[model samples]
Target: MQLERGVRTVKLKDLPEPKPRPSTEGMTRITGRGTSMLQSKPLINIVNVVASATIDQRLDLKDVQKKFPELEWNPDLFPGAVFRLKSPKTATLLFSTGKMVCTGAKSEKMARNAVKTVVQKLRKGK
Candidate 1:
């Protein structure tokens, strides 16, 4: 069938070089090769995670301010309302556009829990 779809050419380079093994025992073995080994887990602490959410309804900052007087809202400085939680220890930003930004959580799990707490509070009102 058409000469089995034509023929192809191949080339092989000549082996012309030789290298010596490392003199150290660590390098010769499979493990403990300098500081290049990969660890099973990372070695740092989780401190902060920023998360966002968009609500379907719009918000009124003036009404929200009256409802939650503890929340800090300075229209001259910033547009969003700043709410700080003591439980998970996170600072959340609530916008009138029904958007939220949460930060300063110790871990991913904590960050998610903090966001849930904020939403629950918003739904339940002050």
Candidate 2:
């Protein structure tokens, strides 16, 4: 009898380390929709997920910008902006609304955690 075998390959790239943004708790508010009394808060919009691994990996802003030119890839403003996660195997998405959608997360907890982290950062203005 004969047996079949399969092989997988992995590649390494020089990606940038995750850079956490500053806290945004006391940051000034940015004008948004609604009446003047209703001010809008600042937030991060993470998008795309090219690849990820068990261990945390770095993300290439330039590459991501090249891919999604529409998005405003501002490292200074929203650093630590990652679309993919290692353990959860998930990707984040942003929309015009003040909400984010996390896709591909292994479990609900991962998705919630991702959103919570982002929200906390936004609240902190980081």
Candidate 3:
């Protein structure tokens, strides 16, 4: 049906009102687990590890920086030393207290490798 512009064919009150929600008293919860077609492991992304060690004495960041080419340290800005490694790829932070924080490792194996690499390098540096 064609109507003239700016005209109401039906009254606003004539429109049907929304029905109220049904009561939940008659409902029953499903007790059994549902079957699944997909059998894939859950995605576990972004794993990080923070570790510490107690050295015999306070570690010198400058010395670590000088020894490891991959290490970056600026005593004027921060007291921590950073060693970044590729291959299972992670960045480890070394502090004067012999504390270390390893981040960016995808899995526990990668984190262990990163920590082991750092410890091995530090041991060799001594």
Candidate 4:
């Protein structure tokens, strides 16, 4: 089929109607366990929320690893210790510089909770 740009053209077969596109007009952030209330299907779903925090003092990665055996730490391979939480299902990277980067959280509240949990566990070891 050839379509003319400037001039008019005619075809024997009628043109089919264009399909309606999925709308994201009423889309908003999800709250609690339920999804956003929209006329059409949800256009967005939050898979991961990354958050960062820092402490005042330096962290002893070696001692932290020893204290929390569940924490995965290999200074030779990676400088940060991976501390995973079960409740929020988040992985927080703990560095010697007292810096923390949390990932795999569904929401900001969940990310904050995950970081708080990790900090509490670290403090308990001291």
Query: Once model 2 is optimally superposed onto the true structure by TM-score, how far is the C-alpha of residue 109 displaced, in angstroms?
Result: 1.2
* Best of the two (1, 2) by lDDT: 1
For candidate 4, report its TM-score. Answer: 0.66
lDDT of 2 by residue, 49-103 (tens): 3222221334444654565554454667665344444545555654323335566
Cα RMSD to the true fold for all candidates: 12.3, 26.3, 12.6, 10.1
Q: Which candidate gets the maximum lDDT versus the true structure?
A: 4
Error of 2 at 57 (Å): 31
lDDT of 1 by residue, 56-95 (tens): 7787888888878889999899999998899999989999
Q: In candidate 2, residue 77 scores what lDDT?
A: 66
Clashing pairs in 1: none
Which digits, one per residue and each the tens of the lDDT, describe model 3 over residues 1-126? 444447657555565755535543334434447542333344565656554444546787777877887688877888788888886588888898887888888777778888888788788993
Compose the digit string of candidate 4's lDDT tens values, residues 1-126: 645545876452555645545454335545566554544463578889999999878999988988988989988899999999889899999999999999999999999999999999899883
Residue 53 shift from truth in candidate 3, angstroms: 5.4
Stretches of candidate 1 off by over 4 Å are 1-42
Model 1 TM-score on a 0 to 1 scale: 0.63
Question: lDDT of all predictions, in order shown?
Answer: 0.78, 0.48, 0.72, 0.86
- What TM-score, over all chains together, does every model reach? 0.63, 0.31, 0.56, 0.66
